[model samples]
Target: MSIQDFFIFNCLEEKDLPLLHRWFQEPHVKKWWPVPKEKEDFFDSYLKRIHSTEISLYFVSYGNIPIGFLQAYPVDRSKETWLPKLPKNTIGIDQFIGEIDFVGKGYGTSFIKKFIDQLLAENNEMTVILDPDPRNKAAIRCYEKVGFVRVGIFPRKGDLALLMRYN
Candidate 1:
């Protein structure tokens, strides 16, 4: 399905809390990024992070259903615990489909493309970065299909990820 038909990009808001927690706890997402967070803690942290000028969080909605989360950030300014270093002024994405049933459906790829399209519309000259685990072949292929080129590998904190970019 086309992005305009299946998905909507929106700023994360208070009313989205329940869905956010559900997304956080999904087995698919938790398998990759585990956290033992209570609902309030998660909400507070999400709010605090998104309020920073260097980051923007978007809730990925598919026909009014909260299906995933996406974030764009200036890599140089992030105090996030695990992000890799990138060239100054470059932005990167962190995204996932929290619904297990949606896995392998190619929705994540569409989300990346549509979100970047919207971002580039706002700033046509933006450079975008992505780092997916070297083992996630599907993700790597999908990113390449969306025009991001693999640049190099960066191993951070025992995890090795393939860094890719679109300029």
Candidate 2:
């Protein structure tokens, strides 16, 4: 099936926390997202911030089956020192395909492109940014396919990342 046919995006709800917690424990996801060792602590923290005005989080579905998570926030709202250097209206994005079966299937590129398109439509002046691990060659390539150009490499939370932008 085509990517568009399978993908659906919905606002994340409090009821979804358990599933998200499970996804966080997955080896593939844990490698990038430093989810807290204690599930309750992680859930509490996420619940507190999920409703922030500066952030938006969504659940990614494929033909009604939830398969991933995506989130976006104003770059300036980030605690990372380097993010404020981006344009004023820039939005930073973070996402992961939670379902193991969905990896390497080209779904990420399709869903990310659609999500960015939606974000831009909602706020015409906004610029989108992403910082993926430099070692994740597949993710970097997917971002490139969706028009994100690597601006530089930078440190985030003590780890190196490839800073990419789409305007």
Candidate 3:
């Protein structure tokens, strides 16, 4: 069941840092999302103290209750280094259901559907992508339900990931 039947992507702000920090510490999140421990380091994990223009961060909420975090970024063709060549208009996503109580209750798929729908509505031709740890079956399943197609495995963040692109 969904919580309050609402899925919103609230613009992230400094005020949400504490909540964000707490989410990073959740065991479920820690299992897949290896993030910094300390608040300062954790903030850094968000990149340039959340000032990066490359990504858009959001607080996913069910009704008025914050349930998770989601971030989207465009692959910068100019800033080359690693990363397999992707579509020039590709948009990558990273997200987690922060509220432990909300895990595995179908909300992840619901939120993702709404979020991706919005992104496509904005730019239907824009390619959306996500790379989940090869072992994160739950996440992979959720993503698949939302229309992501398997694109093979690749090294990502010190581990192999099943890079999937929206199709």
**TM-score of each candidate?**
0.83, 0.92, 0.90
Estimate, for each residue in 1-167, the C-alpha lDDT of model 1 and write its tens digit.
56656789888777776787788787777766655567778887777876777688889988888788888887764453455555565788988888777778888888788888888898887789888888878778889888899888877668787889985
Give the top-scoring candidate (TM-score): 2
> How large is the C-alpha RMSD of every model relative to the true structure?
2.8, 1.8, 2.3
On lDDT, the stronger of 2 and 3 is: 2
**Residue 28 of candidate 2: its Cα lDDT?**
87
- Score residue 99 of candidate 1 by CA lDDT: 79
TM-score ranking from best to worst? 2, 3, 1
Residue 96 Cα positional deviation in candidate 3, in Å, after optimal superposition: 0.2
Regions of model 3 farther than 4 Å from truth:
1-5, 44-49, 77-82
Please identify model 1 stretches exceeding 4 Å from their true place.
Answer: 37-40, 77-87
**Clashing residue pairs found in predicted model 2:** none
Model 1 vs truth, CA RMSD: 2.8
Q: Write the per-residue lDDT of candidate 3 for residues 1-167, one digit (tens) a residue.
A: 44435898998887798899899898999899878768788776664646778789999999888999999988775663346788789998999999999999989998998899899999999999888888999999999998999999877546687889998
Candidate 2, 1-167: lDDT as tens digits = 56776678888888999999999989889888888899889889789867777788899998899999999987775567865376788888999999999988888888999899888989889989999999988788889998999899987677788999984
User: Worst ten-residue run, lDDT, model 1?
Assistant: 77-86
Query: TM-score of model 2 relative to the true fold?
Result: 0.92
